[model samples]
Target: MSEEEWIVDGIDHLNYRAVEGVYLSELNVGLKKLILHDYPELSDSSFVSNVHLVKYRLIFMKNVIDKANKKNDYVRETVYEVTKNQAYETMDVQEEWDNTITFGQKIADIVARFGGSWTFIISFVFLMAVWMAFNVLKPFGLVFDAYPFILLNLALSTLAAIQAPLIMMSQNRSSDYDRLQAKNDYRVN
Candidate 1:
């Protein structure tokens, strides 16, 4: 091409021409918008040389453009697709999952919280102390559960059976949430 034909004006009103076989002025408007969106600091300032902008766009937006092209999406305007993908990727999956949790899951979380607290421990200790004291101090014929405390044993065993599963369910949910967070972080990075 002639030198005059090679020189063209960029979106920022700066003149650019073929540099190392890359033509900045020939870039698609959508790609220009994507470059601007990716680098807000470059949006307002005119680049001293077109070489830097061309190199940056090629290095940074190549993957995004290729992915958009592969999906056959944003063929006319890649900025929209890129922005939409970024928004979706950065969304809080944990909050969305928490919102979708079932009533059973909420109950399991509550049970797990209460089971791990000092209040449960203190109240259980107090109840056992009172039970032992009453049974030991009362007359022999009036004692309902003797020193063996079979009723207490059965109740404790049932509580353990129910509590173990609830705690495990909550832990599984916590692990799932952590995994989701890691996935989001990986995507964002």
Candidate 2:
């Protein structure tokens, strides 16, 4: 767009305006980033700016294809066709769909992956049972803890208070690792 933005040595060396009638995929990498900024202009009536960006990309890709066609024409042609058929609208739609699917799948995945963690549940149940058993069996002389057992109560309360957070810490670390694995797996494909 500005004279200062032009590059002649790398991608900046090629004059995009020199091939104004080309398609989108042929454009060079630098020009591609430049053109990506004008995606919103596709809806305009004239479409001159949008067309120019697409043409630059098309030209760049075509140049690469020309050099490599003799050794692998089929691959080059396929690449060219795929590139040409892709437009800003198609890319935008794919991006939106990817975002939606990612969010939805993350929710489902988290639930399905670690939702049944039993440690927390078991600890909670055990803690409650300890309290109840102590109260219920007091008259039976199962006196591991006796009436007004302040020391026993203190020990139970302290263990519960400390152990709950430790269990939570372990759960959190595993969950974090699982999430990291999921993210890496998604990216690899």
Candidate 3:
């Protein structure tokens, strides 16, 4: 190749244009040190192509991750797993969780979603008002439940008892998902 079209790479010793990567002369001391940490044999004037640069960049990342003071071994393991190019070893937290849901968990999720909505609140208020009005005013000329509304109290109490456990179950699943997401984020970072 013509001298103007191709220049020699100081590290890989291949003929490449300057635009293909970068010259070590342009790098700061710390950056040069990081590069040299992986390719120690490279001279002070090394020219690195982009492809080889990517590999060294990964090494630089590994060095940074290794030096990190994070106390979580899960994060460290995930970083190592990714650095080793075993991407398939890691799973999508949401997808895995969704795939593992049981019928009871699905019902709990639906109940929790509805119980926390405006529609449920409005419907509940309207039902209580209608029940009290029907029993006290005797609008239908026959009050099945008297002013005390014993049946309404029983229904409300039962609803509360069942709703509480379902909502708690949903919250537990949410907490698990948050934990899985945290671990997954570490792998990406």
Candidate 4:
């Protein structure tokens, strides 16, 4: 590719002036595709992959190119406004928060974070002590979770299952945000 190729990820808007055999419309299509695939929620408008979006951007770009070739000042201004508007419209609601949040799910978040090897070992030891205490204190019959604490086991199992998915969801969101930020930075330079 030539140094003249304007590749903007998002910064101040990608602008390339002069030279090139490639159609700006094709370039825009590729860009939209990248955005849609990388960010699924952004494509919810049912138009992110629409041919019209590509055509609109291309027509605006072509207008600017034609005017620039003809040394027309108004053409540059017109294309700038039109292209900017279209691009903004396409980008407005591209962020999707599908599996984002809930209030009482904090327990899931905590379990997901500390349910690793070390945590499991520590919990096992703690449960063991609790079980021994229950046996020793059985004379008083005050053991809430006794030797066969099926309910307690079920609760932990359920927590691990739910928390695991939420943690994955959070990780995915972080990855997406990082990608979006990187794209924005790329566009600027």
The parts of candidate 3 lying over 4 Å away from their true place are: 1-82, 85-90
User: Candidate 3's residue-wise lDDT over 1-189, tens digit each?
Assistant: 333577678666888886787778676676688878767888766788887778767877776787674646778888688678655366778789999999999999999999999999999999999989889998758898896889999999999999999999999999989998998887666
TM-score of each: 0.52, 0.27, 0.54, 0.34
Tens-place lDDT per residue, model 1, 9-92, is: 333445655342334334566655666665554433333245556665676578777887877754546756556755554577
RMSD of each: 14.6, 17.9, 12.2, 21.6
TM-score of 2: 0.27
Give all candidates' CA lDDT scores. Answer: 0.70, 0.53, 0.83, 0.55
Candidate topping lDDT: 3
How well does candidate 3 score on lDDT at residue 13? 82
**Ranked candidates (TM-score, high to low):** 3, 1, 4, 2
Which whole-number lDDT from 0 to 100 does residue 145 have in model 4? 67
**Where does the lowest 10-residue lDDT sum fall in candidate 2?**
40-49
Query: What does candidate 3 score on TM?
Result: 0.54
Tens digits of per-residue lDDT for model 2, 1-189: 443442222222344342233333554455555555546343222223334445666866776778787659777787779768654232343344345444545554454344346875787578767766786687566666555666667886996686555556546645765665566555443
Q: Once superposed on the true structure, which residue ranges of model 1 sit more than 4 Å away at CA?
A: 1-89, 139-141
Model 4 clash number: 1
Could you give candidate 4's per-residue lDDT for residues 1-189 as a string of tens digits?
Answer: 565655332222344332322332344564555545545444332322233344545766776688688877677778678668554322221343334445534444455467655977798789867776776578676766666676678877986687678778656655776676577655543
Ranking by lDDT: 3, 1, 4, 2
As a TM-score, model 4 comes out at 0.34
**Residue 100 of candidate 3: its Cα lDDT?**
90
| Model 2: how far residue 33 lies from native, Å | 34
